[model samples]
Target: MSHAPTHVTCSAVSFDWPDGTPVFDGFHWAVGPGRTGLIGLNGCGKSTLLKLVAGELSPGEGQISVAGTLGYLPQNVTLDTGARVDEVLGIRTTRAALHAIEAGEATEANFAAVGDDWDVEERALATLDQLGLARIGLDRTVGELSGGECVLLRLAALLLARPDVLLLDEPTNNLDLRARHRLYAAVESWNGVMVLVSHDRELLERVDQIADLRDGEVRWYGGNFTDYEAMLAAEQEAAERMVRVAEGDVERQKRELAEAHLKLARRKRYGQKMFENKREPKIVMGARKRAAQESAGKHRIMHTEKLAEARERLDQAVEAVRDDAEIRIELPATQVHPGRRVLTLTDLHLAHGARVEGEWEVRGPERIALVGGNGSGKTTLLRTIAGLLPPASGEAVTHVPTRFLPQRLDVLDDGRTVAENVARFAPHASNNVIRARLAHFLFRGARADRAAGTLSGGERFRAALAALLLAEPAPQLLMLDEPTNNLDLASARQLTGALESYEGALLVASHDVPFLESIGITRWLLLDGTLRPTTAQEVRESRWDG
Candidate 1:
């Protein structure tokens, strides 16, 4: 597909938060046609840049120019539940005008409203169906849809507009597998200029190119996420090699400087002996001494300059190496014995009225993945297991200390700082201890002092995870519901790394297949009416029919 060239251009753009935290300063970017996946670490201003290009935000400096009509789907999709579908699709007036004309009211105003879109309803429905929302009638209310459906519906609206440029931020955050597939198809079919800001590897693979947003600037890559990673790995390898060479150069320069100093000292000692022995006239000896002293000073200056240059090169070489390290969390006390039963669900009935026909036992440090579609009662089951909700029929019990991280991350207290929140969970732990552990979760120094309410999406997730894993009694059974929902790629990998150090049993309910696989899940349970044992391959390859 051929898209207009230079569809979006941002020049010397700068933006800052109300608290004076800088995001971008003199940033410049130009995106042409085809799908461009915008990827970066969390809180790097990828979403903010998209918003600026969509005209939802004004830059504090510079200018952004879009060549044609622009459409944007923000990270969070929320619509009035009471609103009609047509209103959400942004075609209520046109639809009503067409209906009025059909009803024999041939007013010029109605004709103007209807204008070239006599088939707007058909197009809207077609777009909905294309996004796997065929059952969602045009007259239906927004309240009748599921969370994943809402995202697709919003995308359907944008598609109906047929804008020249489309900007999507984290479009697959809450979508399930099937919905993600539908979204992927939509992206593949997109013919106009599309810039997608996402951490989803699969969705990014469908893009024609990648715009790596880092340090408030965009770095263009010729291919998709996989290609970008490969290129980055090669670049890192070359940088590391350069760093090694620079270190050697710095050491050589230092040694040469030391040798020159030693040689100059020996020459001074020899000159001193000749002066004392009266080998020549005192004036001649003094003149020779002066010349030697001046030569020594010049030599010292030359060696010092060379050493400084070598050290500067070493500094630049070190800076070229990336510093993307995963969090290193150590939770020895959370380990569970292989023979010990961590959790038992005996003919359990969920809080949402879903029942498990047979008993399920989690032993040792087994990692369990709870797979289900939207409205499959996964959260309710987790809540029941955590004892936050009463079971409808049978028993849900945990033999060891347990912790639950819900989809909303309600475990955190928004009013308190991250340290205070963790302290709330582990009151017996001292402030120093809490800060120490939070540091392991990548929340060092003043970062831990930030209020939970002020944290970005990824920061909040990390804080919540820290609180849960660092709680007193060392939760032996940890249950997480959609933990990766709003996490960027780096944050998700960080979560997986944190879990790697957790020796306890894990029951994670999520639609993120790659994440579940990364945590070394020992078992998979498909949660429909009953918890059926399944395989990771089956989960990844097969479609969810329920």
Candidate 2:
């Protein structure tokens, strides 16, 4: 597929963190005027690359060039709560100037400030409306908006800038289904050079191409995430086949080398016998012995060189094969009987004015998905159920042993190792058991000894998940709040595999429809003003009414 002309270029760029953690070294990439989905395993420098291109970060070596204006929406957006929407949109001064001129104060400075943006307010409102933020007036304070709304509001500001290049990192992270759709539409309509770093599958489906960042280099794939996956799968298949062929070559070389050694031993023994028999003059025997030794040494050297070359080829072939280790855990102890009652709620009134009236019960090993728009109290409800938060006017009780994995993944102690953290949760399990269990979570041997604070995003998630699942008494009811929020595709898939092995009750609060579906959610509850039973289709189809 053809792409737009090149708009951004990075030539032999190199960067390293202050702590000496090497990120990218001599990385080169050229992005054109079309949507490019930047993807990789967590901590592979996808976000760092975007930051470099956006000029938030400077490369240590080489150069980067952008053809036009640039705008960047970071993964974590921090806005001054006290600031007005217009101020955050960067039009506060312009709007003030326009208002002054409209009030009959047509000063030279006012005209200069207003410049050509005579309809600044209209344009700002239009941009906000386009991002499903029409309800958020320009005069409103940032504190008044929900997390997801604030994300969209930031995007709106970028849209209003009319930048030539746009960078968005995890743009759909906290967004609800409706907000995601709005963001998707905005992304789909973008005509500039757009680079989006996200784990959201649906958002990635709209991109023109995929830029896969791995091992400090970028590989371009024409088309979206699905296309990238297809291409990667094919590549991996070929690499695996080459590995097998290389392995066979190495074995054959080893056999040939062994056979050469055997032949040399036999020749040496025959020469020794001839010398012992004294069948020729001493000089002749000595000369024949030297010749045989010389020939045997040459033969051994040739076979050894061939074996070394074959081994090197095998190593290269193995390196080409990706080793994305998966979590393979068994949670038979977490299983609840088919007829057991796991949790119950009565007149559940959350802290944020959201409620679940009357009686609510979760029985057996039911997997329920709690989904809603931002500020709909999904987290609040989950916290209340986990006993971390007190309900405003009701009670939520879990009959079975339970554990909650919050979105922040704060379950782990930063100072503790993975094994120690898991031990904290599973006090009854021995160190060996804990270490063995952690292996299933992909934290093996030395990896389990790494401090929680030192882990990458995906590693931290896996560690936290292992701690929660391996807790003492084997939590029969697991509550998770936006568990997949910042997870990479591979990490997300690992979580799915781990969850599939869990035979307990699951109440997951998430906006990730694909993840919820993957975990085999048996029930869907939409948390608006009240908790109401819903379906996945409705959740996907529903738009944010706020």
Candidate 3:
């Protein structure tokens, strides 16, 4: 289908952090009137590019041009809790003007304030309703809303403004399934030029194209996330094939060079023998020797050049192959017998009015996914189960050792190196053993020595996971709260892989359905007002509400 004309353009854009860390150098891209998913590794500058386009950050050396007005929903939505919804939605003045006019105050100022938006309140409410915020009225304060609701409120403001260019950064990060569906619908219905930076696979599936930002450049893929994966897989396959071909060429060139050396040596030896035997006149023999030497030198140089060219080709081919390393570590001590009781919750009443009416028990290596709407106390439940928080009533008992990886990822000490953090967890293990085990988590040598605070989002996640899994006593019951919250696609996959090697019981509170399924969650628990058993299909279909 014919698409809208390009509305956003970046020309030779270059950006650098204040500390001299360079992000983009001469980056250029043009986005048309269609949903574009900007994705990459955590530190590949996807969010930075969005900030540049939205005028939140200035480029060091280039121009960012947009054809029309822009609206941006940043990844972190921080609103004044005291502010009313209408004020946040940019309609408080208009609403006041309408109310004043209705009260017979027909002033020019009120008329001007109302301007062309006579239906401003209706539109604002409609936008909020579309974003699953119908329960939240325009008169409500931001403080009354949950974190996910605040994100939707910000989105509602953007939608109400109806800017020509829209940018959303990790829009679904705090949203639940129902709210995410509403956001997905809104994205599907969006017609203006849009760019989204998110790790939410479902949200990305609604985009028209994928903009993969990597290694200081943007590569466009034509389609949604699944299509991008297909194309990327094909490209990687071809790249691998080219690498093999280039490697073979290099080997062949080496062999040819070796043969040339042997031939030249043999010829030189034969020439020397002839010279020694005086087979020909001294002058003729000298001329022959010189010619032979020159020929051999030319032959050697020709082979050397070919070898260098082959090596260059191999290097280029290798560059084309992506290096998305997976986390692979063994935790034999984390294993539990099938009949082992890992955890039990009896008549639990958690903070925020969430409870388990009856006895609940986790046995063996059961992978349970705790899911619910935002503000439904999933995190609270996990914290209580992890012994970090006490339940308001009843008890949560862990029969085995437990480790909790919170959403904040505060398990590691920022001042310490990755190896040091692991050592803190595995205190009984030797320094060499700690470093050796950390290598399986993709933190090798110097990486293991780097401070946790200096690591990127993905690297920090791997380090935290390594520390959690490598503890001294070995946690037989592992609890994670929104583990994939800010992780990139690759990092999420690495987490899944790492969990596959985990032999303990898993309790994960997350909104990431794809990730939960990939980790082989054996059971699904909906933590609404109470914890109840559910299925993956029921969760995905939103049929759990009764």
Best by TM-score: 1
Q: Ten residues in a row with the worst lDDT in model 1?
A: 1-10
Q: Return the TM-score for each candidate structure.
A: 0.94, 0.92, 0.92
lDDT by residue for model 2 (131-212), tens: 8899889999999988898899999999999888899999987888888889999999999899998899999999999998
Candidate 2 lDDT score at position 433: 92
User: Quick one: best lDDT, which candidate?
Assistant: 3
| Model 3 lDDT per residue over 392-505, tens place | 999999999999998778999999999999998988899999989999998888778878876666677788989999997999999988888778899899899999899999
Cand. 3 TM to true fold: 0.92
Candidate 2 TM-score over all chains jointly: 0.92
User: Candidate 3: minimum summed lDDT over ten consecutive residues — where?
Assistant: 1-10
Q: Is candidate 1 or candidate 3 better by TM-score?
A: 1
Reference-based lDDT, residue 232, model 2: 95
